[model samples]
Target chain A: MDTLINIPTMAELSAKGEQPDILFWVGCAGSYDERAQRITRAFAKILKHVGIKFAVLGTEEACTGDPAKRAGNEFLFQMQAMGNIEVLNGYAIKKIVTACPHCFNTIKNEYPVLGGHYEVIHHTQLIADLIAEGKLVAEGGAFKGKKISFHDPCYLGRGNGVYEAPRKALEQLDADLVELKRCKSNGLCCGAGGAQMFKEPEPGKKDVNVERMEDVLEAKADIVAVGCPFCMTMMNDGVKHVEKEQEITVLDIAEITARANGLL
Target chain B: MLAQIVFTLVFIVAVALFTVQVRKIIRNIRLGKNICRNDRKAERWTTMARVAMGQSKMMVRPVAGLMHLFVYLGFVIINLEVLEIVLDGIFGTHRLFAFMGGFYSFLIGSFEILALLVLLGVLVFLARRLVVRLKRFSGVEMKAWPKSDAIYILLIEVLLMTAFLTMNAADYQLQSRLYGHYIQAGAFPVSQFLSPLLPSSTEALVFIERFCWWFHIIGILAFLNYLPISKHFHILLAFPNTWYSNLNPKGHFSNMQSVSNEVKAMLDPSFTPPPADPDAKFGAKDVVDLNWVQLMNAYTCTECGRCTSVCPANITGKLLSPRKIMMDTRDRLEELGKAKDKNGASYHDGKALLDDYISREEIWACTTCNACVEACPVNIDPLSIILDLRRYAVMEESNVPNSLSAMFANVENNAAPWKYAPADRLNWAQGDWSKE
Candidate 1:
């Protein structure tokens, strides 16, 4: 935890006439939300620990227009998209990684049409790859024998067909990875997607996150692992809503891997 | 010869009525905005084959899948016998294809078996709807008509299959008795069991056979006409619906080219703007505003409610039911079609799909999770229609919830959904992990 990690911005790297291996897209929630910031740090720490050269956009990073697009402001979404694409294309960035599924989805899938194309990947996919490459040796330090359920982020799982990468990262933890009744392609949304995190849920019998929490509790999982920052916030709020924060813990897959590897 | 002439007239009328109804549906679908889904012909064929013909998506629920497969196969295979019926009716020949010998026997035997399977499938479907009462069948949108429509189709299948088997049974009895024109032609595996139930009188058997033959053929023709108005139209539309599926990654919502052009002009001084049509709208306000594929999706939806069952908004008790969205679209389209027919093409009902049929509450409740899209067996994209409605609501009407308005303002001014400064974006990296 006390290890010195070198963090460089894309501007700093460009100033030195050097380019990192990848540009880490720290999304709006990752940059602004306190809880999501921890996930961003954990993922960055993993990248640093694995000796992967990566740089952050820092002040140059803006919203990927996911919320605006989903919330029905196509004009606003395009403006934001064009701005981010210009910055990215200017950097001549070839590959990108993000802890947020929304950013990963937008940049990887949606941005190409607007003249910005990069080999975008989610943080979990990168961790899975690192583990596969033996660059990151994940040991089950605290999570061993504990029942961990992975909550699929809508954009990452159903939206983008990435179901296994996060689970692969969890598999290395040597924990009992129990699946929620609805997992993978059928995975339920955590209610924070489609910009719902910004607004109160339209009145219903229960909040969508609260409904998803029931799935986790039904599995009797001691820990709920997530891949997206939005899901992280929603699942955490769900735990609080159920007053099970004392018994059940919610952590992002990056944070879990970071903890299990004793990097945090 | 007189009987053949009367049969030909009846067949012509049935086919003509069916053609008229189908043409109306096509016209209604064409009323929608044009979208190019014809790209990737090879992929579309594969999708149609896999999703519609192969019932690939149906396998999500094994019980319903298998039952549906039985009915679907039976319905398709047994319909081949209709060709012989049509030929015989035109030429005044009994078992016109009976000269094919063993192959004809094999075909008749297969049809008999398929008819039995169709009966079993229809019964199970009825039981699922009436007795077990599957949750997918019962929704707020499933009122008297929708519920009965399902039952009626199942019951119609039962009656049709019964008439076919009864016709075969009488034919079998007459053939065994060596009655006139009742030639020993085709095999009857299933109807052989029913031959025992018939009377020994040859004339009575012939009368029974003739009655069932007319009934079965007329029922099938009536069923053909019934398809355009019924939810059962999916039997035909599912193929094209799956073919023209939104093949992009489910996460990738389509970018509006019109909005893109306007945004480019705003951002770049050198960018040229296209001459705008005064009537151009941001997104769908009514059925006519939706893309043709989306309109076909409305026609393709059989009210299975698989989309609603998997929808997070619907599952958590929100008002958004994706099945209802498709149903409402189809209903509004039908209403508009009828209005146009009456009012000569410039019909205005003053009601749009957005407010009148689909509510603002239902529209706002969606999380855009694509669960409904993933759940649809025929690849019906209720999410696309929902998103289009959302676009209209936000872009044209500027109608949004208070919280979303604030989020929009933040994204507009501060470059994030929250009120945080862009300068503080890198603050997360400065966090002292050493404190832990």
Candidate 2:
């Protein structure tokens, strides 16, 4: 594994009077959260191994204001949105790929009206497309015959109707892809959306993550794959809650692809 | 002549009262703020055709969908017989459409078959509610009136279909006996089974037929008027509601133009801001603040609880029930409409939808995952109302939960939801992934 991966920032690319093919939007969770960072790295490794030119916004990127918008603070959401739009438009960025469904959803659907229009896609979508093109060959070296189930993220699945892309990426692993009963459009939430990640769940019999984890457990998969950073956190917590961290693994789709393709 | 006069008077009064109630409902819906749902005309029509007219969304649960389709098709097709009934009631003629001969018999045969299907469907629906007690039907919002309203509609439909079949059975027997004005112009495929049960005397058959005819017509009229007040209103409103559905991607929550303008003015000193309306409120506090499409959605809800049942929060025992949000909005709107009717338009009951009807706990408990919106058979958007109510709590009243307050502050200051510094955002990249 490459310990010192050379990642270019948009600022450096702009100073060189050059532009990459895509701007990697390392969302706040992917940037700061310890677990999600592995996903960010795995996805970056895949992009690099496939020779796809991409640049990160580095410190210049801000939250896509999804949480704030969901929390009902339109003012704060717009402020963050406008700030990010200014930076994105300044870079003349045309296409973006992110590992966070919240960022993917916000920039793809919500930013056009604020004068920030660009083609935004989730990392799983990019991985799926790359696999379709035969750019990243999946040998399923480590994950061969493993039972894996993909958890649908709210913003990515029901919110935007991109259910097939993540599944397609996972399909490349050549693993026994088990499905949770509540998958696809009917998938359950991880209790972290709409800014619920920032607050305690108002009195409930079971945490939303625990309820969702029950579906994962019933599916009896060895590894539960996820597409979004928030799902990563919630599903990981759920695995820990059930003390199945040793038996059941929670891996992001990109991480699985990275391992299966021998990229990491 | 006396029977014609009495029937016409009852029909006129029923229609007039129905018109009055429908107009009031339209007025209540119009009380909401205007929105431009007219942009995608072609797509809107297609959606209406597929969802409402075609009953596509109802088919998500095949059994319920098929049953609903049976009842719906029966109600619409059988109502054609009502046209003949109205003409006969007015002109005092018997079986006026009998002039069409065999074609008329074919039509009545189809109506009889459809009426039987409707009866069977209604009984199953009643059993689902009362006997099976589906968890969706027993939601907290389904208490009292909502629960009973569903049962009443099914029972009424049962009665109407039964009366229709009995009227046909009595008429068939009378026609067989060649009684006065009982022409052999109709077919009774399903009701033929009932023909043997009628009395053999011609006079008794005439009395039974005439009494059933009168009962069926009056029941239909009463059912028509009851629609504007009951959840049965979905029968009429579903078409328009599906037509006005949000055609954009489901993830898209509309940008508040009012907030965008204010933010632009704050950021760019050179930008000239439009003059603000003094009456502008930040978000929805009551029904009037919501868009007319949302208000129509409230009226279109059939209290199916499909939304609440699928809600992740509700499933996990959180207070957020999307169906309840719609119910509360409709209930509050009805209350306001009544108050306005009694005392001029300015009347305020001082009870708003936010804290009074839908509590902060309920709205805050929402994950805004759009599950409810997706599950709605009629495309009702309870999430929009929940978001708008949350906006009222956050912007208008600054009454957010303590946890979200910190998140709001952090987003405003740190550019992220957490307390992490902006510079540390790139630190994740510098880590030694080889160690793992």
TM-score values for chain B across all models: 0.98, 0.98
Candidate 1 residues A1-264, lDDT tens each? 445455799999999999999999999999989999889888888887888999999999999999999989998899999999999999999999999999999999889999998999999999999999998877887998999999988999999999999999999787998999999999999998888889988888999988998899999999999998889888998999999998999999899988877778
Summarize candidate 2's per-residue lDDT along A61-166 as a digit string, tens digits: 9989999999899999999999999999999999999999999999999999999999999998998999899997766778889999889999999999999998
Task: At residue A83, give the lDDT of candidate 2.
Answer: 98
After superposition, the stretches of candidate 1 with alpha carbons farther than 4 Å from their true spots are A1-4
Worst 10 residues of 1 chain A by lDDT: A1-10
* lDDT tens per residue, model 1, B1-436: 9999999999999999999999999999999988998899999999999999999999999988988998999888887899989989899999999889999999999999988988888888899988999988898999988888998899999999999999999999999989899999999999999999998899889999999999999999999999998999999999889989999999999988899889999999899988887888998899999999999999999998999999999988889999999999999999999999999898788888999999999988999999999999999999899999999999999999999999999999999999999999888877467433
lDDT of 2 by residue, B1-436 (tens): 9999999999999999999999999999999998998997999999999999999888988999999999999988988999999989988998899989999999999999999999989999998988898899887788889888999999999988888899899899888878777878889999989989888888888888888899899999999999998999999999999999999888899889999999999999998889988887988999999999999999999999889989999999988899999999999999999999999888888889988899999999999899999999999999999999989889999999998999988888888989999998889778576543
Query: Which residue pairs in candidate 2 collide?
Result: none
Interface root mean square deviation per prediction = 1.7, 1.5
Residue B399 in model 2: lDDT: 94
